[model samples]
Target: MISQFFVLSQRGDNIVFRDYRSEVAKKKDGQEEAPPVFNVDGVNYFHVKVVGLLFVATTRVNVSPSLVLELLQRIARVIKDYLGVLSEDSLRKNFVLVYELLDEVIDFGYVQTTSTEVLKSYVLNEPIVVDAARLQPLGPAAIFMQGTKRMPETAVTKSVVANEPGGRKREEIFVDIIEKISVTFSSSGYILTSEIDGTIQMKSYLSRNPEIRLALNEDLSIGRGGGSIYDYRSLSGSGVVILDDCNFHESVRLDSFDMDRALSLVPPDDEFPKRDNLKLK
Candidate 1:
């Protein structure tokens, strides 16, 4: 369980804070940077950085480190979904809104719901949009833009609350397939180990919240000797892809997964990893 939650700017200014049980002491000034998870005077702290802001949670009892970190990330995403841009200025301008979100997201140190759509009904304050154009770009791209014109439109710069001229909400969803490949070489330059970690990320802005159907490659095989028809083709080297293992989100339905390699589900309001930990043979 979380005892306290707060947000701090890069300069270490406390932007937003909520103390549920008061089990942890108040943050002191000029606190040095620490690991994502650390202990202080018997209290444990879990934090994650997003858009130059630190989202932190403190607890006194032993809890899952991954769970708390994921909670922090989800909270940050929910805030960004409402504020459009997630910066120190945005959190400051939408103080009330941020508090309302925290209140709904966690009740008395217990997480209730982190979904942005679910919290929309409880949070009434409209977010004060931040000017993305005036803010400096993050990462290596900032160096290249020293003398260039304004940056182009990016996903982070768009506000979810903004509607069209006729007050119609945009209906769009984005899916990104990201993969990281790792290889280890021996002393003789021989490949000792190779693997790929992949995930399917999705973000939805559909108002009606309709069910979505995502179809995978027809020649996809789940394992080396799976019973699927694609398994035989894969063994024959007929341009078939093999996945040693894969995992899907809880919202996914697998009724048609074995037959056609398709997934059906109603996506959440915020961005999330729909499928993850895909291991290729």
Candidate 2:
């Protein structure tokens, strides 16, 4: 769980700060805060520097510290993708949308949703006029201020407005499977070591929440239509590309794949690598 979140500038200035904890224990009886720097006595911090900003998250309890850093990295990417860059000026200019985004990305230190496509659907690229009607609820239980929400009186580009429906377009998807093979030979032309690396990348422009499944064969041979059909036992004597210890994208359903060896997923808009590397020895 996240206890506190902060965005500081290169000069160590607080750009934006959010606290998930309802009450902050004072350093002493009357002290309003701890030392502003990341290193306080007991608080554990995980921060990453990105684009002239110090993205920091503080946690009072023991938790996976790397998760906070990962969340911050994703937030940086989302902001950069939506606002063009991740600078103090951009943060100030688009503070409204930034706040809205942070609320959507995380809630009470638990990751809510970091899907850029879904976020982009609601978060536009222009300025927003925060109003009762424009500030749409992300969902019944998504990013919202606990007590009350007051949008900052900051100006974004007038062209970018939230809750606009122009982004709803029919999408086209493309999939690419890449493999690289390298072999080393001795002076007598005797093979020393040969290795293969493979990756599956899919570019999806489909509408929101589309489930996709991509299946491949062990022998890397095409049978009927666009499919790979092979018998592993028969191919044991021959050569076949078997993906071992494969790593998948977050959109992939690992449980389903574990059950039937089918690559099932909800593809993001950008080209997502379905597997990290299919190594061959």
Q: lDDT tens string, model 2, 120-167?
A: 666544633322224455575455546765443222221212324565
Highest TM-score scorer: 1
Q: Rate residue 142 of model 2 by lDDT.
A: 58
lDDT of 1 by residue, 1-281 (tens): 89999998898888999999877778666566699998878899889999788899999989999999999999998898888788888889999989998999999999999888788778888788787756554688678658766535455466666664576788877777788988888999976766678999887778878999999888886754545434444576566767777888888999998999899989887777865454432
How much lDDT does each candidate structure score? Answer: 0.81, 0.63
- The per-residue C-alpha lDDT of model 2 at residue 213 equals 75
Candidate 2: how large is its RMSD? 14.6
Error of 2 at 204 (Å): 3.6
Candidate 2: regions farther than 4 A off: 10-13, 22-39, 80-90, 108-111, 115-203, 208-244, 250-265, 269-272
lDDT of 1: 0.81
TM-score of each: 0.79, 0.50
